[model samples]
Target: MAIILAITNSKGGVGKTTTCANLGAALSAAGKAVLLVDNDPQGDLTKVMRSDPKSLKYTLANLMNAVLDDTEPELFVNRAVIEGAGIHYIPANSKLAGVSSRLVALQMSSRYRGGETGGTPCELVMARVLELFQSQYDYILIDCGHSMDLLTINALAAAHQAIVPVQAHYLAMEDMADTLEVIQTIRQGINPKLAVGGILLTMYQGRTNLCRGIQDEIQADYGNAFTVFSSPIDFSIRVAEHPIGAASIFAYEPNNPAAKAYSAVAQEVLSYGQK
Candidate 1:
């Protein structure tokens, strides 16, 4: 079975999509079978992996909807899984917003409340889709949106662990608390095996006093509770350009310091299976 990791944060622009793509690329380069799942409605990860999201007939939303309708997802799952930059991935688009709303509606419905629907729980809809792919890959990385909505919750419920990417800033440190709390809630109420893989400090300017201070604060606050990855992703234009360039950092700029940092992160992740 794959070690499923959700690259998530409750705050946007914290490098969730970037981590999901680059980490998968790094692992794939290391001879691991990687599957990236774009869970965000913005489809940023999909855009980075797929030349055109609209050109695809199926998506993550289709798989979720298949589970919602209690249909065989294998039909759509195969078509949705596409390869890019040496990683297989399921793309997402704005249509996922409708799926989120359906989850909300189901949560509000008495039929769902009474189990009359007799289908997977709203929070586990994505989990049902991912279960089919779990055994086929070494790692499954989910790129989540910046919210604790049903969609993000579904990702958490499905994942074995979460990799939180926080920017090296005081405010980002503050946001980390809410993200951890959500993970804890899921661990307590939904997936008991769910663990936090680590907190990754991204957009780091190690030379700056401010970045160093935030990094220290994160390590001090979260280190004892969860891992604070030793490797901090250095702030670089190359990272921000990967999605636009439609390639992972390894493909875009293998020698870039940011790529090396992600490779370090991947090493730390691989060490998890060792332990």
Candidate 2:
């Protein structure tokens, strides 16, 4: 079965996209067939995959648009094959940002919306993707946009797990409650198999009491949500300036402590649902 994880943090700059890309890379490197779904409308993950989408043929937006056509769903998805890394990426674009409103527009114009058994069109798009593509991947990692809107809901509905990346900042911690509430609601109704994959503490420093305090508070609230996540991503320029398609910390500096941390988390995720 494909292990689908939605990498999201309601707060931005918390390493969600980085985690998704790198985890996809790491898992693919470990001989797993990984499919990375760039669900972020910002197109950051897509930029990371293609470095530049200007030259790409079809993006996630196109794929979603093609859902209405009579074609194999994968035909619409861009299968970006990274050399030596058994990975596939379904790239997104800035155009994806308007998807929600367009979907809402669909609701207002379609008779389906007025029906008794009507449902959100956004929710169905990803379910179709999963039914068609999940079998081809050992892991499908969805890199969500920075909001709990329709796209995130669609991603959450299609995935089995969610990995929330949080930074060691006071304000960032506040968003955790709302995000978790959304997760709880999704789990209760939409996707019963969904669970908190883990809470990753990013931008951390062991020397700060602030880091420890935040970790403690989170654990207190969610019962030690992170079992094997890394300490902090640290203040590294390399992490920020890496070229598109370049390997993340795992490939750039696998020996680094931060890389080791992400690898540990990757290992934990790999062990999920195992006997």
On TM-score, the leading prediction is 1
- Stretches of candidate 2 above 4 Å error? 68-74, 77-85, 107-120, 224-232, 243-245
Report the lDDT tens digits of candidate 1 across residue range 1-275: 99999988999999999889899998998899999998988898888875577676789989999899999898897889887757899999888999999999888783645755567888899889998997899999999999999999999999998999999888887788999999999999999989999999999999999999988888887889899999899999988776454568787688988899999989999999788
**Model 1: runs farther than 4 Å from truth?**
110-116, 243-246
- Which lDDT values do the candidates have, in the order given? 0.89, 0.73
The clash number for model 2 is: 0
Give per-model TM-scores.
Answer: 0.96, 0.88
Writing each residue's lDDT as its tens digit, candidate 2 over 1-275 gives 68889998787888888888777777876778888888877778777765465565566776666553435657654453333335677776676766666655665656464633344354667767667676678998999988887789888988888888888888998887778889889889878988888888887777788888987777787766534254445645666665544647665677766666666677777888683
Ten-residue stretch with the least lDDT total in model 2: 76-85
